[model samples]
Target: MTVEQNSAPDTAQIQLTPDESIVLFELLSRWCEDGKSPTPEASCFESTAEGAVLHGLLADLAKQLIAPSKADYDSLLNGARDRLKGNWDFPTLRG
Candidate 1:
C-alpha cells in the first residue's frame, strides 16, 4: 500500500480542554511505545486518574481562555488571523 493508503484523514472534531490535552499526550505516548495508531476506542481518556486530571485542567483552561460570547470568539479569531498574516505581534508580557 502507498503512504496515502496507510494514513487516514482526521475526521474527529474535538473541543480540546487542557486536561484532555494531557491525557491525549499520554495515550499517544503509549501508542508510540506499542508501535500502533490510536484508534477511536483507545482515544477515550475518561476513566483513568490521569484522564480525570486532564479533564479538569481542560475545563479550567476553557473557562479561563475561551470567550463566553460569540462576539468575543469572533474578535479573537480575527485577531489571530491578523497575527498569522504578520499584521501584528502577539501580545506577550516580558518581565
Candidate 2:
C-alpha cells in the first residue's frame, strides 16, 4: 500500500492504485467524449458544485494517467476493471 503524498498541508489527498487510476481515466474520458451528463438528471453534472469537483478530478486524473494515450487503451482498461472487481462474484438465490 504505497501512497504518494502532497507536501502541502492545506489540501487533502486521495491515493489510487495504478489499475484504479487507469479505470477512472477511461470512465472520465468517455464522459467527456460524449458531452452528456453522467446521469439522466442534467442538474447532476451541468453547473453545480458536484460538477465542479468532477471536472477538477477529471483534469487531475488526466495528468496522472498515461494509459488513455496508448494504442491498447481498451485492453488496459479491461485489465484494470478485472483487477478492481477482484473476487466479488454476484450470486443468485431462489426465494
Candidate 3:
C-alpha cells in the first residue's frame, strides 16, 4: 500500500480497506471537531487555493481507506495514528 502525490490532477492515489476507511473517518471527524472556524493557514480547510489541496489529500485518503486490500488499510491506519499521535497537541481553533 502506497500513497503518492503527483503533478497531474488525477495522479494522486491512496489504497486502503473498509475498516481503514472507518478509522480514517473517525480521525478526520476528530480533527473537524478539534478544528473549527478560523483555522490556521497551515491547517485551514476553507481557503480557496489551499483548500483544494487539502480536500484532494483527504479524498485520496478516503479512497485508500475504502480500497479492498488489507495492506492498504494497515498502511493508512498506521500513518493516520502516527500523525494524530505526533500532533496531539493541536490548539483549539475556535472561541
Which candidate has the highest TM-score of all?
Answer: 2
lDDT of 1 at 68: 29
Q: Estimate each model's TM-score.
A: 0.28, 0.66, 0.31
What's the lDDT of the predicted structure labeled candidate 3?
0.55
lDDT of each: 0.50, 0.75, 0.55
Is candidate 1 or 2 superior in lDDT?
A: 2
Clashing pairs in 2: none
Model 1 score (lDDT): 0.50
Q: Which 10 successive residues of model 3 have the least lDDT summed?
A: 1-10
Ranking by TM-score: 2, 3, 1
Candidate 3: give the clashing pairs.
16-64
lDDT of each residue in 1-95, candidate 1, tens digit only: 89997796756445854334444444444544345665335445555776556556545544555342446654554555444445335574231
For each of the candidates, give the backbone clash count.
4, 0, 1
User: Which is the winner by TM-score between candidate 1 and candidate 3?
Assistant: 3
Model 2 ranges off by over 4 Å: 1-10, 36-40, 43-47, 87-95
Candidate 2 TM-score to native: 0.66
